[model samples]
Target: MSEKVVLHYFNGRGKMESIRWLLAAAGVEFKEEFLTKREHYVKLLDDGALMFQQVPLVEIDGMQLVQSRAIMNYIAGKYNLYGKDLKERALIDMYTEGIIDLLDIIMLWTIETPENKQKQLSNIEQKAKERFLPVFEKGLANSDFLVGNQLSRADVHLLEATLTLQEIFPTILSTFPKIQAFQERMKALPRISKFLQPGSARKPPTDEVYVKTVKEVFSHIFK
Candidate 1:
């Protein structure tokens, strides 16, 4: 039986990184259809292919899946990455949702204008240190994984979120030793390790401007 899974997203990782991680970790073979140009995505929207008017659309077995989280959950359910049972699934959702909230803030740094982008970066630094880090630190205080002993979608999501933060705020995770270790453990996974390698499509593009600005803004901590 041939199962076809096609993922549509922008050329960069953005919201699709976790989905890529989940697919790769599950050893699922899929094709990436990059919507590189605005017209490409506009065509899809005009065709009504994207119900939610967004990218990160996954086509599996001829059915279109919209919403990044929904696509991830569907993939996870198929691969058993969601959880062992209902209770575990609930915990997985909780952790994953919390990570998504932090990711939302980090993504705001992508704003085009320098002033707004700088403000977003500052907000990211403040929130990561004050609100997000402590929550994950306590959550992972005992377990290596977010939900259970084994890898779950929550862990995958968290890893993507951490890597995204690391791109701009390189030293942000230093204070959260547990998350630092968790990141290392996730990166060491054989499948995940391959996806993270240089030149891998799963890697997001480096925003040089964002990196320089963040370094300057957080020079005190970096020093």
Candidate 2:
């Protein structure tokens, strides 16, 4: 508990970003190492730091964790952001998974060609409105938290996912007042408020430069 968490990823918001959100909300201090070039990634691969040869790798509690979901689960449990009992945990899992599915569509935007970005962004908005946001809006209808009477990882993920969408379309959440309120409430937390400030570890939306860097770093897959 004394050692700080270490996160590895690109300079932009990729999968590691959600991990950053979870850590910040958990009040755990973390240091981020941005992958600036192919060599940074290659070094980790050669050092056996990445379990599945991927980024978003985290070092915490003397372990090198990979996979965003797994890393999140560990952080949630450690920080008591997971619910108290099995049933509550199951509910939290359900809501968290749904939020992640929506986030997946946002990730697809980074690979979009210049001509396709707007079309792809429209598609993302459609899914967020029709499929995802409504679910959270309903889940949060009568309570401050999603699964239980307290804040959990599900709440944090919901907030992060909505914020990411709003980055592209500022009015995306205007129709969902409940989620809008929930987003503000989460941001007001002392730790979370700090993370949202300028010059924090929170990365901006991926841009052309970030896309090019990622493809260059992992050219084998983007092909």
Candidate 2's displacement at residue 130, Å, is: 1.1
Q: Which stretches of candidate 2 lie over 4 Å from their true place?
A: none
Candidate 1 lDDT by residue in tens digits, 71-149:
8889999998988989999999988888888877666556346777776778778988897778888889999988877
On residues 1-223, what C-alpha lDDT tens digit does candidate 2 reach at each position? 3267888898888888889998898888888788888899999999999989987899999999998999999999999999999999999999999988888888887778878877797788898999999999999999999988999999999989988888888999989999999988999999989999999888888888998989999988879
Compared to the true structure, candidate 1 yields what TM-score?
0.85
TM-score of predicted structure 2: 0.95
The TM-scores of all predictions, comma-separated, are 0.85, 0.95
Tell me the spans in candidate 1 whose CA falls farther than 4 Å from its real position. 206-223
